[model samples]
Target: MNDQGEELLARVRAVLSDAGFDETATGAEGVHLIRHARGVMLGWLPEDLAQPRRRGPRRSRRPAPADLPGLRRAFGLAMAAALRAAGLTVETRGDEWLLVAFERAADAS
Candidate 1:
Protein backbone atom coordinates (compact mmCIF):
# COMPACT_ATOMS: atom_id res chain seq x y z
CA MET A 1 0.00 0.00 0.00
CA ASN A 2 1.08 3.57 -0.66
CA ASP A 3 1.70 6.00 2.18
CA GLN A 4 -1.63 7.70 1.64
CA GLY A 5 -3.43 4.39 1.61
CA GLU A 6 -1.77 3.35 4.82
CA GLU A 7 -2.59 6.68 6.47
CA LEU A 8 -6.20 6.45 5.39
CA LEU A 9 -6.51 2.93 6.78
CA ALA A 10 -5.08 4.11 10.09
CA ARG A 11 -7.61 6.93 10.27
CA VAL A 12 -10.39 4.47 9.55
CA ARG A 13 -9.22 2.21 12.35
CA ALA A 14 -9.18 5.18 14.69
CA VAL A 15 -12.71 6.15 13.73
CA LEU A 16 -13.91 2.63 14.32
CA SER A 17 -12.25 2.61 17.70
CA ASP A 18 -13.78 5.95 18.62
CA ALA A 19 -17.15 4.58 17.59
CA GLY A 20 -16.74 1.81 20.19
CA PHE A 21 -15.46 -0.87 17.83
CA ASP A 22 -12.50 -3.05 18.68
CA GLU A 23 -9.49 -1.84 16.70
CA THR A 24 -7.60 -5.05 17.30
CA ALA A 25 -10.53 -6.97 15.88
CA THR A 26 -9.99 -5.35 12.50
CA GLY A 27 -7.91 -6.69 9.65
CA ALA A 28 -7.27 -5.92 6.00
CA GLU A 29 -10.60 -7.61 5.37
CA GLY A 30 -12.51 -5.08 7.55
CA VAL A 31 -14.21 -4.43 10.92
CA HIS A 32 -17.73 -4.14 12.19
CA LEU A 33 -19.36 -1.66 14.55
CA ILE A 34 -22.73 -3.06 15.45
CA ARG A 35 -25.02 -0.32 16.67
CA HIS A 36 -28.69 0.38 17.22
CA ALA A 37 -30.84 3.51 17.15
CA ARG A 38 -33.58 4.15 19.68
CA GLY A 39 -36.18 6.79 20.34
CA VAL A 40 -38.85 7.32 23.01
CA MET A 41 -42.36 8.56 22.46
CA LEU A 42 -44.80 10.15 24.87
CA GLY A 43 -48.53 10.37 24.40
CA TRP A 44 -51.81 10.85 26.28
CA LEU A 45 -54.38 8.06 26.53
CA PRO A 46 -58.17 8.19 26.63
CA GLU A 47 -59.89 8.25 30.05
CA ASP A 48 -60.28 4.85 31.64
CA LEU A 49 -58.30 3.45 28.81
CA ALA A 50 -54.67 3.89 29.79
CA GLN A 51 -52.30 6.49 31.16
CA PRO A 52 -49.62 8.28 29.14
CA ARG A 53 -47.37 5.69 27.57
CA ARG A 54 -43.75 5.84 26.59
CA ARG A 55 -43.32 3.93 23.37
CA GLY A 56 -40.24 3.31 21.28
CA PRO A 57 -40.06 3.74 17.56
CA ARG A 58 -41.00 0.64 15.67
CA ARG A 59 -38.09 1.08 13.29
CA SER A 60 -34.57 0.91 14.61
CA ARG A 61 -31.10 0.28 13.28
CA ARG A 62 -29.74 -2.94 14.65
CA PRO A 63 -26.35 -4.50 14.31
CA ALA A 64 -25.93 -7.73 12.42
CA PRO A 65 -24.60 -10.73 14.24
CA ALA A 66 -20.83 -11.11 14.25
CA ASP A 67 -20.11 -12.76 10.94
CA LEU A 68 -17.57 -12.60 8.13
CA PRO A 69 -19.82 -10.92 5.61
CA GLY A 70 -21.21 -8.48 8.14
CA LEU A 71 -17.77 -7.45 9.26
CA ARG A 72 -16.60 -6.95 5.68
CA ARG A 73 -19.53 -4.72 4.79
CA ALA A 74 -19.21 -2.59 7.90
CA PHE A 75 -15.47 -2.29 7.52
CA GLY A 76 -15.70 -1.41 3.85
CA LEU A 77 -18.15 1.38 4.52
CA ALA A 78 -16.08 2.77 7.35
CA MET A 79 -12.87 2.70 5.37
CA ALA A 80 -14.52 4.27 2.38
CA ALA A 81 -15.92 7.08 4.47
CA ALA A 82 -12.57 7.72 6.07
CA LEU A 83 -10.81 7.82 2.75
CA ARG A 84 -13.34 10.32 1.47
CA ALA A 85 -12.72 12.51 4.47
CA ALA A 86 -9.03 12.48 3.64
CA GLY A 87 -9.73 13.58 0.07
CA LEU A 88 -8.89 10.24 -1.42
CA THR A 89 -10.80 8.12 -3.89
CA VAL A 90 -11.40 4.47 -3.09
CA GLU A 91 -12.29 1.82 -5.61
CA THR A 92 -13.13 -1.75 -4.80
CA ARG A 93 -12.24 -3.98 -7.72
CA GLY A 94 -13.61 -7.45 -7.29
CA ASP A 95 -11.43 -8.75 -4.46
CA GLU A 96 -8.92 -5.93 -4.65
CA TRP A 97 -9.06 -2.59 -2.86
CA LEU A 98 -7.59 0.50 -4.48
CA LEU A 99 -7.08 3.91 -2.92
CA VAL A 100 -5.98 6.95 -4.94
CA ALA A 101 -4.65 10.11 -3.35
CA PHE A 102 -2.87 13.19 -4.66
CA GLU A 103 0.81 13.33 -3.83
CA ARG A 104 3.55 15.71 -4.83
CA ALA A 105 5.89 13.97 -7.20
CA ALA A 106 9.56 13.90 -6.24
CA ASP A 107 11.35 17.11 -7.13
CA ALA A 108 14.31 16.63 -9.46
CA SER A 109 16.01 19.67 -7.90
Candidate 2:
Protein backbone atom coordinates (compact mmCIF):
# COMPACT_ATOMS: atom_id res chain seq x y z
CA MET A 1 0.00 0.00 0.00
CA ASN A 2 1.14 3.53 -0.67
CA ASP A 3 1.46 6.20 2.00
CA GLN A 4 -1.97 7.60 1.12
CA GLY A 5 -3.63 4.19 1.39
CA GLU A 6 -1.88 3.53 4.69
CA GLU A 7 -3.01 6.88 6.00
CA LEU A 8 -6.59 6.32 4.96
CA LEU A 9 -6.71 2.86 6.52
CA ALA A 10 -5.21 4.18 9.72
CA ARG A 11 -7.78 6.93 9.92
CA VAL A 12 -10.65 4.50 9.30
CA ARG A 13 -9.31 2.08 11.90
CA ALA A 14 -9.00 4.83 14.44
CA VAL A 15 -12.54 6.00 13.84
CA LEU A 16 -13.86 2.45 14.11
CA SER A 17 -11.98 1.86 17.34
CA ASP A 18 -13.27 5.11 18.80
CA ALA A 19 -16.79 4.09 17.82
CA GLY A 20 -16.40 0.89 19.91
CA PHE A 21 -15.34 -1.84 17.42
CA ASP A 22 -12.85 -4.41 18.61
CA GLU A 23 -9.97 -4.98 16.25
CA THR A 24 -10.19 -8.46 14.83
CA ALA A 25 -7.48 -10.78 16.09
CA THR A 26 -6.33 -11.24 12.49
CA GLY A 27 -5.82 -7.44 12.39
CA ALA A 28 -5.95 -6.84 8.64
CA GLU A 29 -9.15 -8.82 8.24
CA GLY A 30 -11.25 -5.92 9.64
CA VAL A 31 -12.85 -4.42 12.76
CA HIS A 32 -16.28 -5.16 14.23
CA LEU A 33 -18.63 -3.75 16.85
CA ILE A 34 -21.82 -5.53 17.96
CA ARG A 35 -24.74 -4.13 19.87
CA HIS A 36 -27.99 -5.96 20.51
CA ALA A 37 -31.01 -5.02 18.43
CA ARG A 38 -32.73 -4.04 21.63
CA GLY A 39 -30.05 -1.51 22.32
CA VAL A 40 -30.54 0.09 18.92
CA MET A 41 -34.31 0.35 19.15
CA LEU A 42 -36.05 3.51 20.28
CA GLY A 43 -38.03 1.73 23.00
CA TRP A 44 -41.04 1.65 20.77
CA LEU A 45 -43.95 -0.67 21.40
CA PRO A 46 -43.52 -3.95 19.59
CA GLU A 47 -45.96 -6.74 18.70
CA ASP A 48 -49.72 -6.85 19.18
CA LEU A 49 -49.99 -5.35 22.62
CA ALA A 50 -48.17 -7.99 24.58
CA GLN A 51 -46.94 -6.53 27.87
CA PRO A 52 -48.14 -2.95 27.74
CA ARG A 53 -46.23 -0.18 29.40
CA ARG A 54 -45.31 3.46 28.82
CA ARG A 55 -42.14 4.22 26.93
CA GLY A 56 -39.13 4.64 29.20
CA PRO A 57 -36.15 6.85 28.54
CA ARG A 58 -33.04 4.96 27.52
CA ARG A 59 -30.27 6.88 29.25
CA SER A 60 -27.40 5.39 27.32
CA ARG A 61 -26.66 3.09 24.43
CA ARG A 62 -25.79 -0.35 25.75
CA PRO A 63 -25.34 -3.85 24.35
CA ALA A 64 -27.68 -6.74 24.83
CA PRO A 65 -28.39 -10.20 23.38
CA ALA A 66 -29.25 -10.31 19.66
CA ASP A 67 -28.67 -12.33 16.50
CA LEU A 68 -25.32 -12.07 14.75
CA PRO A 69 -26.77 -10.67 11.50
CA GLY A 70 -28.78 -8.08 13.38
CA LEU A 71 -25.76 -6.98 15.36
CA ARG A 72 -23.61 -6.74 12.23
CA ARG A 73 -26.25 -4.70 10.42
CA ALA A 74 -26.61 -2.32 13.33
CA PHE A 75 -22.86 -1.97 13.65
CA GLY A 76 -22.54 -1.24 9.95
CA LEU A 77 -25.19 1.45 10.11
CA ALA A 78 -23.58 3.13 13.07
CA MET A 79 -20.04 2.76 11.73
CA ALA A 80 -20.99 4.38 8.45
CA ALA A 81 -22.61 7.27 10.28
CA ALA A 82 -19.53 7.76 12.44
CA LEU A 83 -17.21 7.79 9.44
CA ARG A 84 -19.34 10.39 7.69
CA ALA A 85 -19.55 12.37 10.91
CA ALA A 86 -15.74 12.39 10.98
CA GLY A 87 -15.85 14.13 7.57
CA LEU A 88 -14.74 11.25 5.39
CA THR A 89 -16.39 10.21 2.13
CA VAL A 90 -17.94 6.74 2.28
CA GLU A 91 -19.28 4.28 -0.23
CA THR A 92 -20.88 0.96 0.62
CA ARG A 93 -19.08 -2.10 -0.68
CA GLY A 94 -21.91 -4.63 -0.47
CA ASP A 95 -23.18 -5.28 3.07
CA GLU A 96 -19.84 -6.41 4.37
CA TRP A 97 -17.61 -3.31 4.26
CA LEU A 98 -17.34 0.34 3.32
CA LEU A 99 -14.89 2.20 1.14
CA VAL A 100 -13.90 5.29 3.08
CA ALA A 101 -11.54 8.04 2.09
CA PHE A 102 -10.78 11.69 2.66
CA GLU A 103 -13.21 13.94 0.83
CA ARG A 104 -11.71 15.53 -2.28
CA ALA A 105 -12.83 18.60 -4.14
CA ALA A 106 -14.14 17.94 -7.64
CA ASP A 107 -11.97 20.79 -8.97
CA ALA A 108 -8.76 19.29 -7.59
CA SER A 109 -6.13 18.75 -10.26
Query: Per-model C-alpha lDDT, please?
Result: 0.40, 0.52
Tens-digit per-residue lDDT, 53-105, candidate 2 = 44786432322224234655666778789878888776665555566744465
Clashing pairs in 2: none
Query: Residue 3 of candidate 1: its Cα lDDT?
Result: 60
lDDT string, candidate 1, 1-109, tens digits:
5565455456555644565544333222133322111111111111222233458855322323332354455555666565456554445533223333344458998
Candidate 2 is scored at a TM of 0.54
**What's model 2's lDDT at 105?**
50
Give candidates' CA RMSD values in order: 15.9, 12.5
Local error of candidate 1 at 86, Å?
Answer: 0.8
lDDT of 1: 0.40
Per-prediction TM-score = 0.31, 0.54
